[model samples]
Target: MKKSITILFCVLLSIPSFAQKTEIIVIGNIHQPVPNYNSDTILTILKSIKPDFLLQEIDSSFFNDDFTFKNPPKENEGLASVQYIHNNPKTKMRPFDFEGRNEYRKINGFNPTEGLAIKLLDSLYKKNKLTKSEAAIYKKYNDLLEPLKIAASKDAKSFNNSSNDKICEERQYYQYHKLLSIMQERSEFSNTYYTKANGEKISYLKGFQLASEFWDLRNQTMAKNILHIAEENPGKRIVVLTGFMHRYFIVRELQKQTENNTNIIIREFYN
Candidate 1:
């Protein structure tokens, strides 16, 4: 009888350990105008293990954007879309937005975070590694960005009587160079190919290069602030929503941290 009792006690002690295992779940999906999280196979997968946090690819602006919910269907709404779900205590889910131009600008810099892609590629350009095709691509990028630069420069001048240092660095590096190099380093991949006004084919490297630049820093400082919040809320589960591409990079990097064995859960959606 004593032997049986001892076995039962050991089983009871092990139950909590099994329950406490830190989980790192990664999800991937495409962006849809109307998010499809409800019908996703991952719904059952996620419901089985309720997380403490939900990380999103979006900037924190959503919290204050005051945008009305325009959900696709009743059953497939997110905590953010489903007004009632966000208010539930049993789920204990909280929204965590990344810093950016849209909102939290004072802390994270620009919104759309996509803006960083240009600066990152410009850094490579300053290194004399950008090719002729890449140079043309840069021109297009500039064209797409001219309006933003004008606005940012104006804002910086008004705010500090000078351009932002970070903004200036990007401008200097991206300024036209006399000679351009063409090497297929991961930094110079093409995104869209188009002929220039001169009828020469542009490398379309800007988009891919910008994306590479983002991935290079995603683990470094881009996600640093978010990680801090995650660390502060110990024992709290989190869900981070973010660009589909970034989902993979963020999860992999978190797994590398030594200070805490954080159990990450990743879910990707296409909308």
Candidate 2:
């Protein structure tokens, strides 16, 4: 028994830590104009990198073996990358994004569009369904976001030096991360998502709370999924291609995780 135990211990010690052995690179992607960055450029870059697995931002629940119900279409950056991999007979590609089915599942069935939700709430306030205070608070919270939204819209409209035209990760980070940070700092807006109205608590933040939670839960899930996959397949190279908007949260969370898990090396695509 002692001899057998010693052999098992030796095997265990020979195995390397997950972090020290694996390479995880997170790349930001552009969505519109299918070939804007130009598919050839994207493909060439990916070919050289040669990732073992490509983790995408898209939800996987939409795809089938037939590829008939493709979620975003092949022109989208994420799908375009997939198309490139398929053309290469030598490359082995595995899909990591499940079409956000996980995010959809985590939401507990509350499906409300951001614009629609806000519009409905505004109408409710108009109809007196919401108290004056609730309406006023809601307005105040949204008012804070108006400036950022306007700035983003204006930046996009210019069609010049707009990250929207390209992944342009650095520019996107510097410009938008602060807005998201501000949103996070104002915890007051989330104080009571819904208040009691006629014995039923109504969500005062309306869809705002749901949307915030959705992104948070989604980012957290993505991080957990990446870590879990890495641990299961030690030394595997994984590249996560997500929309630039998610870069701030995903990178932040992944870096924090690395403090405890020193074995894996997390690298930015730019680096």
TM-score per prediction, in order, is: 0.42, 0.57
Q: Which whole-number lDDT from 0 to 100 does residue 208 have in model 1?
A: 33
Model 1 per-residue lDDT tens digits across residues 50-83: 6555444444444444432333323222533233
Please give, for residues 1-271, the per-residue lDDT of candidate 2 as tens digits.
Answer: 9999999888877776522368887765544543234445456657767776666665545556643236545644565566666765444434455345545533532333334345655665578766555656555555554443333343222222223323333333322343233333444333434423234443324345455556667777788777777777677777776655565567677878877775687875545
TM-score of 2: 0.57
Runs of candidate 1 with Cα error greater than 4 angstroms are 1-24, 33-42, 65-88, 92-98, 101-212, 218-222, 259-271
Q: Give the 10-residue window scoring lowest on summed lDDT in candidate 2.
A: 155-164
Of the candidates shown, which would achieve the greatest TM-score relative to the real structure?
A: 2
The per-residue C-alpha lDDT of model 2 at residue 252 equals: 70
